[model samples]
Target: MTRGDDYVLGRGLADSVRLDAQHLLWKMHKGYELHPLIPRTDNMKIAEIGTGTGIWLFDIARQLPSSVQLHGFDISDNQYPSKELWPKNVSLGLLNSLIDPPAHLVGQYDVVHLRMWVPNIRGNDTSALIQHVKSLLKPGGYIQWEDADLVHQYVKGPKAQEFERRINKIFDKAGLDFRWVSDIPDRLTEKGFLVLESESGRFELDSIQECTKTYLLVLREYINGFKKLPDLDIQQMAKEEEIALDQLYLQYSHGIVYNWSPVSLLGRRDD
Candidate 1:
């Protein structure tokens, strides 16, 4: 299993800021934090896996009743805000959702949420992750997963397309397979979670320019961290990627934007 730190992005202030910005972009695109299909109940418990910076929980805290228990868990707590800064109903902790959850936490949540976890998946398999997340849910609990459909990512302009291609190539060389994103529904069903449905959207024209700018900054950070690997070929590719990213960033103002297929799935644990 790959540790969270082994992934490309760094756990720093800049990365946290980028994550918050990226979260907003996703919220704008998806039009909701929690899926509308998820029926809320009084004093329900919600847990977010891979909850970087605890931003999503904070946002949901305002939208839901204060009695709703909102918990954020990640493999690493480096990016978590101070406890004093958290919302009254929000709490942060460290738990690797890829592994079997602790006995105490098993069957404890009414809802389990995960987002942007494509990199954490290894061997193109999600069975273990799904099983573990399922253990955290009570019968009839909902799991909402949000991930980018990178395998089918599109771009409007030629430069943007080339930029995206290079990014994909780098991801391939780095041994990342995001194909599992498109398999979420099937996988959820196989793991005993009834597929409620999935929602997909891209950054529309009005938000494209701003979203692209934020995405480029985050991509640059990914490249910067990836360059630290000892592999020479990856180092060289990362260098070229930096130049490509800069060129692509310049073209965003010219109405060039990469079409990110953000997919969100909501499923219920079979009783």
Candidate 2:
């Protein structure tokens, strides 16, 4: 696979990783809960940063009783749905978070929600991005962030731990902090948000076999991204890891469970 194709595959795999039963329960109970509290009115303006597939935005709009105005911003246009299925209240905008918010969007939203932004946040100067998010929020508005503490993957098992360590080390070497989720709430607070709530959940399966097939497909794509490296030892190790991951997938297909952990941080922009 080419680099672009590999990247697309990685994104697709990550998105396909479903929120299991427990997550569905929380999502249902929470009304797709927003941190710092849900907006009091359906007419509130909402902005979703890095809306993966626009599914969440569409669902939220469908749930609201009033005419909610929604905007989704992403670097990739891939997240948008077909025009025929688009909601009347929703619009899609191309945005590069590393840069300033577009002139049209400044101080325009009531809720600014950002999820799974770890990759971009780690790749760029997050302080600037945080400030940009802040600027986009209206006074007393809220910003919710959902990300994972990837380093916690190390605690899952020997193989998983090693994988987590290696991935994080690579990210660190690339000037990205893979563990940024652990500090995001505090960072938001420092950025002037009143942290209302922060919680984390873990997903543990009986074995990697439980989720191996799905996981391997993802791994194959991710590995492709690094296949161009010149280091012989690294390439050899990656090959071995790929084999192991594939084996785990086989086991999962038979009936095994894999564990994952994700976190949610919600806060309000102080008036």
Candidate 3:
């Protein structure tokens, strides 16, 4: 992964766009209908794994009482918010969830959250991830996760279809089933979690006004991912990707591109 890829569509712009779109999706979700994604707490321990950009955790911290200790951990500091800029209630850490976490963090959180870690989660790691998450929660604590199955999402313009083929090929090779992660309840149950509740919801997007140029940013991500493959040579396609991305934005602006729903799941640690 070159430094250039993470900076695609400009440094932090892609991640920022993704964060904005996710906020709108969560607001529209049914579970969030009764309560906020992160319910109000007086003084509970909260953690978000693979918390990209830290925007969701930041917003949750901002709205919660300062007594609620909030923390976010990710593999890299590349997109993490500056410590000086993060809310006082929020603590940031560098740790890859794919690896064993430090012992001190075990069973320390009352509620743990994960979202959109698909890009990093491989097929075989699915079970191990559930066990690690279960290990992080206090007894009766909650574990919540949200993921989008892009395979079910959108396919509008030719460039969009092109992006789909390439991206889907990569995801397939990685053995990651991204679109149907709402089916995680079974996996959670297998890992000894009490399936408390789960909800699948779609984000309604009529135009680029709602999608916020997210598809382009995601396309750039996959293109960059493809470029990193040692056996693949996509230099020509990589250059064309920039041009195609502009076309995708035009399609989105004109309402030629539409959206599909993302699924969210919630579980409780029982053992």
- Which candidate should be chosen as best, given TM-score against the real structure? 1
| TM-score against native, each model | 0.94, 0.78, 0.82
Please give, for residues 1-271, the per-residue lDDT of candidate 2 as tens digits. Answer: 1113223234443543432322243354344645436656867898987765666677677677548788888776664667778788888877776567877889998888876565455343467767888889998888877764555641434554455456444444435555667787878888898988888765433333333333345456545544555655556656666766665555544444444346787788885
Model 2 TM-score relative to the real fold: 0.78
Please write out the lDDT profile of model 3 over residues 29-54, one tens digit for every residue: 54342235435559899888877677
lDDT (0 to 1) per candidate: 0.84, 0.62, 0.66
> Where does candidate 3 have its weakest 10-residue lDDT segment?
1-10
Sliding window of 10 residues with minimal summed lDDT for model 2: 1-10
Give the alpha carbon lDDT tens digit for every residue of 1-271 in model 1.
2445476777788888988987887888788999988888879999998899999999999999999999999888899988899999999998877778999999999999998887678778888789988999999999998887778765778877877878888888888888989889999988898988877767676567667777777688879977898988988899998988888877777877765678888899996
How large is the C-alpha RMSD of every model relative to the true structure? 1.7, 4.6, 4.0
What is candidate 1's local distance difference test score?
A: 0.84
The clash numbers for all candidates, in the given order, read: 0, 12, 1
